[model samples]
Target: MITLRDVVLRRGVKVLLDGATLTINPGEKVGLVGRNGAGKSSLFRLLDGTLHEDKGEFQVPAHWRMAQVAQDMPETDQSATRFVVEGDVTLLAAEREVAEAEASDDGERMAHAYMALNDAGAHDANARAQALILGLGFRLDELERPVNSFSGGWRMRLQLARALMCPSELLLLDEPTNHLDLDALVWLEAWLQRYPGTLLVISHDREFLDAVTQVTVHIEHAQLKRYGGNYSRFEDMRAEQMALQQAAFARQQDKIAHLQKFIDRFKAKASKAKQAQSRVKALERMERIAPVLAEADFTFEFAEPANLPNPMLVLQDVDFGYPGEDGAGPATIVRGVNRSVLAGQRIGILGANGQGKSTVVKTIARTLAPLAGTVTEGKGLNIGYFAQQELDVLSPRDNPLEHMIRLVKETTAQGRLSGQPTREQDLRSFLGTFNFTGDQVFQAVGSMSGGEKARLVLCMIVWQRPNLLLLDEPTNHLDLATREALSVALNEFEGTVMLVSHDRSLLRAVCDEFWLVSRGGIAPFDGDLDDYQRYLLDMAKQAREAQREQARAAEPPAPAPVVDRQAEAQRQKQRNEQLRPLKKELAQIEQRMAKLGDERAQLEAQLMQATQDPARLAEAGRRLKAVESELATVEARWLELSEAIEQAGA
Candidate 1:
């Protein structure tokens, strides 16, 4: 267990935790949630022993092994699998012992070392590492690729995989889902559910917290408050508690007023002078109840567009992707895409990683031109595009006010400025609406946190009064409250919205429909996020199977074997016996898969009909999850059995 009693912690002169007390039991999956700068990360630092409390007692089990994702971008030439495998310190230690034992030629030491190595999972280390890598959305071919070869985001994923690979009693994850796609996030949620260890995760994703965490620890007003359940439960309980506190505060205020009235009116009179003094003393000694100030509600709205363009944009036979280097042909990611963005339409874009979701968004945003088709915009169409890389569109050296000033200048010069606020004071006030205020508005964008930068981007977008909004992963850096605000704003906005996000809650809230960008094309997804998740899982499974097939195909053919009829017949018989059980299991798995598939389909249909009945919908969802889990298990076993059978035959 981890315990902190009357802990006083600080960053420089700023007190983060003052007399905060918390106790987290062993094996508890906890969600540490707070505002962006609420010291969640600092608390993690304390747990990992990087920081010491300035006062009072803080204790973690002394012998607990801890694993945390490295914040630094990994720059290594080692293969991804190797890098992740090396994260298992016990395995590394065991391997070192084995090497030393071999060098010493000590029989007993060698025997013990081998046993330790096996216990450390040295034999299946690569397999375990690859499983993590794949679960985190890496392609099979990328498993053996150099770690440094990946982009920054992917390198961060590798870092996460590395941390997960480690054998630890305690795991610390900060924003683990930020770099993950929906599929990878789902996989990670499932993985964490099965983790038999203490998990402390700092995340802004509410659904993720609800799915994985049983306890929520909130940091507010320099105090740590423990809640009994998940984030949603915390919110409900917190709301109720705040309401009660506010009522108590109101009652206290009335009492204070009554006492003050008596003291003021009678203090000058000889008859009540003693009583007035007594009352004054009582008032002074009374502990005042602090008013429950509403949390900094960061809410903003899109300025009503000057013009609403029906069919805001149209993509005709579009091919979305990046241009190749060295004068090569363009690399098309999504081809023959025919899509139209109409006014007031809310479309959520869905796809697995590397499936061109961003490519499509970029093309629509005009950041990338379609390789082989025409993109026609409706008359007077104005676009507000929030890219995944918000920084790319921002001038890091420029502050929020400066960015808005420049935007005003650009729009005015282009004769597009109309009723929008253009004055510096108005722009400053507008930025304040998005929570950028005073000195923060003047702070360099580059020095700001990701959430601040994202707010600046949002502020700029809202300032444009766009008829079409294209948001790609806009909620990646936003907290739950801010995400909720965005969802509300988007819902109320009088324009079309095309969003690409891994946040299912946001997607379900904002998107009226979904478009799937897959297999070099864009099409409407018939089902909801649940179906899409299952699709992603199935796609991952197929990709793995395909990679396995490719590996088998790539292997050189074995040299022709000598024909010894009697010996071959005996060997063949032995192979058949070895394969029989495996084959039977594979057949059973196939049958189970079919049964689960049918049940899933039926459940989905039932869910569609059960929308009006909350209880039925909940039950169907639960059963569907169970079926999917079983199906996944069976499919894995089937794959393993099939591989074994093939190897046995060979």
Candidate 2:
């Protein structure tokens, strides 16, 4: 168990926790949540030993090993797999011991070292590391890529994988889902649910907290409050408690008013003067109930657009991707994407991490031109695009006010400003609606927290009064309160919305339909997010099995044992006879899979063409589902047969 009793923690002169006490039992998964700048990360630092309590007792079991994602960017050229494998400290130590024992030529020491290495799982370290990598959305080919070759966000994912690779009794994760896509986030949630250790994570992702946490710890007003059950349960209980508290406070206020009235009426009368004095004493001695003061929640809404353009944008067989480098042809990530963004439609873009969700959004936003074909926009169409790398577009040296001022000037220069405010004061007033007020609005944007920057971006978007919103991972930096507020605002907005986000709660709250961008094409997803999650899990399982098979194939073959030629020939003949039926079945499954694949592609094309015809769309969707189900069944059997044949040959 970990205990913090009467703990007082400080950052410089400001006290974050005062007389705060909390006890987390061993193997419990706890979520630590608080408002931005409310010491959640600071408390994490305290638990991770980077900081200590300023004036109280804090204790954890001395023997418990801790693991946390490194905050620093890795500069190593080591291959991704090797870098993650090295995070297994126990395995590394055991291997070092084995090397030393061999060098010393000590037989007993060598034997013990070998045992330790095996215990540490040295043989499967690469496999385990690769599993973590793949589950976090890395491709198989990236396993041997240099760590430095990945972007900052990808490197951070590798950092998370490294932390998970370490053997630990206590794990600390802060915002683990910020860099993950929906599929990767789902995989991570499943992984965390199976972790056999104490987890203390700080996250603004409500669904993630509800999924992985068994306990909730809230920090507010310099106190730590513990609650049983997950985040949803805690929210329900907390709201109920607040309601009861408010009722009590209202009753107390009435009693105090009655007492005060009585004292005022009798104080000047001699007969009741002593009674008045007694009343004063009673008032002084009373334990008054304080009124519940609600926290200042940030909320904003998009101004209704000047006009709604039906079919806001149309993609006609567009090849959505980036232009190739070095004079090469353009790279098409998602091809033949034919879709229309209709007014008042709420669409969620769904796909695996690298399957072109962002690319589709980017193409629609005109950040990337179509490699081929046309993107037609309706007349008077206005778009508000929140890119995944939105923060990078903001000038670091400028403040929120400056950013808004620049936006106004740019829009005016482009002659797109309709009835929007252009004055500096009007812009500042608008910034205040997003909680960027006073000196904060003038503060450098570079020094602001991620949440603040995200809010600024939203503020700018709202100012534009766009008829169509293209938001990509907009909630990645937003806290729970802000996300809920965003959901409400989005629902109220009278415009088309196309969103790409990993936050399931937001997705469920905002999206009405889903489009799956996959296998170099786009199609309407007939199922909901739950079905998508199951599909991702199934895909992850297949990937892991494939990786294991590849590892087995890469291993050096064992030396052949001495045997009689006649006996070997007899065994070989028996193996060949056994494999004949299996091979035939395997070949048949392959042919069926190929046929099903072709049918699926044809059905998808039909579905795309039939979007406007309800009858044709329904029929195509039904056939596609059937084809997909049969393909899955056939593929599973094919894999089984292949594995069996490989074992028999061995």
Per-residue alpha-carbon lDDT of candidate 1 for residues 1-650, written as tens digits (9 for 90 to 100): 99999999999998999999999999999999988778999999999989999999999999999999999999899999999999999999999999999999999899789879999998899999999999898887788899989999999999999999999999999999999999899999999999999999999888899999999999999999999999999999999999999999999999999999999999999999999999999999999999999876888888889898788988899888999889898898989878888888999999888899998888888899889989999999988999899887999999999999999999989889847788999999999988888888899999998999999999899888888999999989898889999999998998899999989899999998999988888899999888988898888889889878998999999999889999999999999999998898888889989999999999989988844689878989999999999989988788679878988998
Compare the candidates by lDDT and give the number of the best one: 1
lDDT of 2 by residue, 335-369 (tens): 88788889899999999889999888887888888
lDDT of each: 0.92, 0.91
lDDT of 1: 0.92
Instruction: Give candidate 2 misplaced runs (Cα > 4 Å).
Output: 103-108, 268-270, 547-562, 565-650
Score every model by TM-score: 0.84, 0.84
Clashing pairs in 1: none
lDDT of 2: 0.91
Report how far off residue 10 is in candidate 1 (Å).
1.0
RMSD of each: 13.7, 18.4
| Candidate 1 TM-score, C-alpha based | 0.84
lDDT score for residue 639 of model 1:
69
